[model samples]
Target chain A: MALHFDPADLAARRQAACAAVAARGLDALLVFRQESLYYLTGFDTFGYVYFQVLVLRADGRMTLLTRAPDLRQAHRTSVIEDVRVWTDADGATPEAALRDILAEHGLADGRLGVEWHAYGLTAAVGQRLAAALEGVAVLEDASDLVSRLRLVKSPAEIAYTRRAAHLADDALDAALTEIRPGAFEGDILAAMHGAIYRGGGDDPANEFVIGSGPDALLCRYHSGRRHLDAQDQLTLEWAGVYRHYHAAMMRTIPVGRALPGHREMLDVTAEAMAACLDAMRPGNTCGDVFAAHARVIDAAGRRAGRLNACGYAMGTTFAPNWMDWPMLYAGNPVVLESGMVFFLHMILYDDDAGLAMCPGQSALVTDAGGESLSRHPVTLTVAV
Target chain B: MALHFDPADLAARRQAACAAVAARGLDALLVFRQESLYYLTGFDTFGYVYFQVLVLRADGRMTLLTRAPDLRQAHRTSVIEDVRVWTDADGATPEAALRDILAEHGLADGRLGVEWHAYGLTAAVGQRLAAALEGVAVLEDASDLVSRLRLVKSPAEIAYTRRAAHLADDALDAALTEIRPGAFEGDILAAMHGAIYRGGGDDPANEFVIGSGPDALLCRYHSGRRHLDAQDQLTLEWAGVYRHYHAAMMRTIPVGRALPGHREMLDVTAEAMAACLDAMRPGNTCGDVFAAHARVIDAAGRRAGRLNACGYAMGTTFAPNWMDWPMLYAGNPVVLESGMVFFLHMILYDDDAGLAMCPGQSALVTDAGGESLSRHPVTLTVAV
Candidate 1:
């Protein structure tokens, strides 16, 4: 059977979103991004990828304004959607469209919660809208109101995530067998992606950042034309989607022989990961999880760990909706709740030796305990 | 070798974009999308999938305002790129970010041109920007400026597109041989995607839309549990990308004995597609190209002939680019340049026999003629 959001369930989610906006004291919530729009109404068509904005008022009514093509497609996929199409005619401008949607929705005035982080909302649209709507106060930092709502994993979301986890595991296993000496960095990436695709992986978030040798320290480094060598640390941070839920897993392998320093780094990373999970419970503050990892690493005498943070919240799919709350950083004061998901990664950048790779597993947090979500083994594997 | 764009090349493209804006507009041009940014600075990274805006002024000076982390990544990839970091403290709000960037660049009180047709120039950002930069004239439709600059492909870009075209052809060929009765639609899609992945296809924008039986008419319909019988029509639309260059190809096939009406409909589609290709030239209007397909379908006397508006202008990559201008719409008046690329798709929806299929191909406009990018034959293949 095909996977689709039930029309009735969509209405319920919209209502939840509306209530959140009102609770945050927003007269109208200004949604100017794709993830927020898709999260609200399940509109995942190509046309929705524009600077379209939907204003969901406190009164429970909503209106959207976008280009004509997306308007037609948005109507088709959305369970409850209203559109104001903009073309060359009728003074095609974002300001005009924003003005029309606001006036029609009776949101011409009052406090507006804005996603200040989104692009496409130009200074021009802002100027025209302020003049058209008197007393439109903008609210900042309401991301929690929205992010919290999407944090808890639903049953369907978990099922898809589990599949994503399985694909990640399979990709890594393929990498272990294929990441050999004399192989170009691209060959290992190709084999890993091939495994993911065959396992029914969804659109991968990005390309494989396969770093073999000194390049492993710069995790963001693109897989260059470097050959695998003996005693080199191969750090891979790859994830895939199954249906839309994403699973991110990191694995570090010694290409041929394991040096004592590399083996010790992996050991410390594993210990830190386990300690963080030990503090992960329903009522614990997010800081405790961070402290747990930090304490474990500190006790192990590896003070300069690569990661200084905790995990993030997971959701229905990848990229947009699959986000993690930075509980450790930014003083995020939310308690770790049941049904949350995060990736626990540990690293230590040795300024002298470059990036010391020893990051651990990805997992899904439950009220009972933390469940592992990686296919790679916890221990370091020494290649023959 | 890694792809690169020298600082002089960046200067030339920026000058070209600025000239197009001056010819079409009356003020400062705001480049608010990732694709336009990539077009200008050659900042090739996966971060374009997120919220970032690059402003190209009429005077050829540019300012890119994006997330702090993204700013770092952009700088590492491209040598000619310049970026301003925006974080939660420094104008984290869309309006605040727009206001700060505009004020910094000294465009707080001028007419701001925007690429609103694509990307997120979010309404929320627009509304917020209105308050900060008062009395600014906001105009729409600067996408033409970017599109005009992008319409013609470069030599290196064409080489990448050729590679992508071959990948798409190979995937389609693999899928054709695997089509058999009693095969699950899901399993076949998995297999087709597998072939694409093993062939080193693009991680982003490479989507395979496969539909079987009565579900084939949706054009964008994903395959389902619908069993493939001797009477079913299997339709597929798949593309391959190289360094952001894309070439898409689509085809339809019959499982075994084709229905008499199905074979007739397929023949009409194939003929219509071929006729449209033969009509292409260096200087044809987009509307005229679309009209040619309509005439061929009308001559066939088939009421439900090729229904889509053919395809739009194709570029170095695929969608969300202003480069492939003079799209094949009902009333577009842009002319096809010598280096412009286009895709001609003849799709037929036959209700009587419950069959739908497209014979699609891409072409690059040349001095002598438009050359076909795909190597696949357009005739319907019977799978027995």
Candidate 2:
């Protein structure tokens, strides 16, 4: 078995989850999020795109219902002993199978917590699930039950996160060498990913956000790759993943030459990032971190370039993104806690000046303050 | 604009979708699948991970409601003129905003088609949407409407798929050089991805499946990568993505030496793959393709070694996987059509012999037969 966590650690995690379930007055929790499944059982696979669920009872017994492809996968990667497979065929109702599993596990007519917000449970399937279990059980929405527990990292998780941070730094260093004028965005992106993989890192949960020239102002990953001009801006947001734990960083580099607006925006971004990190200490709410960022950026007269959210929590995430719950946006009540990881990015898109500056890095929340996860300094990177 | 399709092509696609909506007796179709959004408007972003939706009316009018980050993105990449941003805030209800948008567009109390099977619509959000729009609109599940249209590729889409096939070939050629004895799976995977990106290919929708040694018997991607021993087997399933169109291929190679069982399994896999591809003509059903694979593998007494499904349709896909609709499985009944692409892999995992062999390639269904997309031949690849 290729379990990522120690058996003892997994047991502790599962016990914690069961405690959470008991506290919520639920007999069992239906695990739908892939992250939650990985956390409790070390079961990992992209097979969650199908209808799969892991039932975790308050008594600590666990059962998994998944497709055939994941039968060997669950056995090999997860510690869960009771694995059930739902045969695939036309008009096959996995929801019915899941209902049967619930009944088999004494969950029928019992109050159960379900991860309703999970990507694994699509709307169509969720509807079917609801219909299949109607009047049989009381299903409560416990979307954040496991995620709240996962916000704080254990020692083993932190160690993997630190390794991911190192790999992120390596990726940036390798990309720096390939970011000179006339460089193709595709080549630089490839170099970054290659560096991570060469360091035994895993594929990130999402595409590395890459855009150049006029596209530099965009923070999202979009199609269409282009070559860097003699004087162009390139924005890149990428993560290094170790055992699915991610350490993300973002930077906008200037090619051949740095314009005056680029330097000004970079300074503003750096200051804002510093303010955000300073406010990321334990006892502070996630809103406080956003306030610090907004204050710095708005005080610098760059409100137009600022975004509504400065950053978000980061951890073991699956496809679609590395962003975890408790996003650092205005008025969010999620409190910062030790061992929490966050990617604090200060993005500035100066549309009027036609310049962009984004400087950001991941940090681990400590009792004292936020500790930098990345070794790269926050400064103007002019790729000459 | 960095639209992947020409304006006329996009307009035609929108028109076809509108026609589908009218045929379904709906006033508008709510597109939650990113593939459908990209197919109609060329607005590409992983932002679909959020509650983003595009409303296409039966009259061909279109509108998008997304988060703030994608404001500029939708404008720059899509032809839709009506892009609405939903502010991010604590207790923010984007579903309410969507309802208001629908009211403003005169869709209130109208029959609306919803893509309930989309990854974009999580169970939680879907429930919220249903509640918010209750009695406001009659929502119908129209998940397969757009997908059915996407099954047949346009000339432009086929061109991109052809380029992706070339990239897949390049990736395999690069990996072959790095798959010798003592090679790390990470290094080989990196080489394959680097080759694709260096050739200007986009990221695959999911992680490229790479496994060696005992793991070669498994088909899905799993954590914990290992190195190849002096005499070992490696299985890889990867795709080349160009402008979001994918052409996937799979191969299992032997390192240093090929065992007798490996050669035997390879022959069985190759013969099954050939039979499957031959059954992929325009008039044949997807079930027929699977039947061909089953006949070849079962006749060789490899029933225990073969999987229930042989292959699946391949095309524009997002995170989680490249497998599209109309999976080649038993009793699928979906008929093959010209211009539809499919990835056919014949896998044989012999636990008794501790050997595995899988060889597959993407093909475009034609009037005469299935045309191979990959240039690589199916054979036993031994890296010495």
lDDT for model 2 comes to 0.90
Whole-model lDDT per candidate: 0.62, 0.90
Q: How far is candidate 2 from the true structure (C-alpha RMSD, Å)?
A: 1.0
Whose DockQ is greatest here?
A: 2
Candidate 2, residues A1-384, lDDT tens digits: the string is 678999889999999999999999999999999999999999989989889999999999989998887888888889989998886678989888888888898999999999999886989999999999999999999999999999999999999999999999999999999998999999998899999898888889889999888788887888778888988889999998999999999999999999999998988988888888789899999999999999988889888733588889888899866789989999999999999999999989888877889998999999778898999889898999
RMSD of each: 5.4, 1.0
Lowest lDDT block of 10, candidate 1 chain A: A316-325
Q: Which stretches of candidate 2 lie over 4 Å from their true place?
A: none
**Tens digit of lDDT per residue, candidate 1, span A1-384?**
233566666667778888888887888887764446656776644343334677778776888777654543465446445777665321336655676667666666557776544433444444455455545445444544556677776676677778778888887877777777666565567667667655655555345555667656644433124677765778787776665567777777777777777777777778878887786687876667777877877887767523435455444432322334443432346677777777666665454665465565567777766788775667877665
TM-score, prediction 2: 0.99
lDDT (Cα, 0-100) at B133 in candidate 2: 96
Steric overlap count per candidate: 20, 0
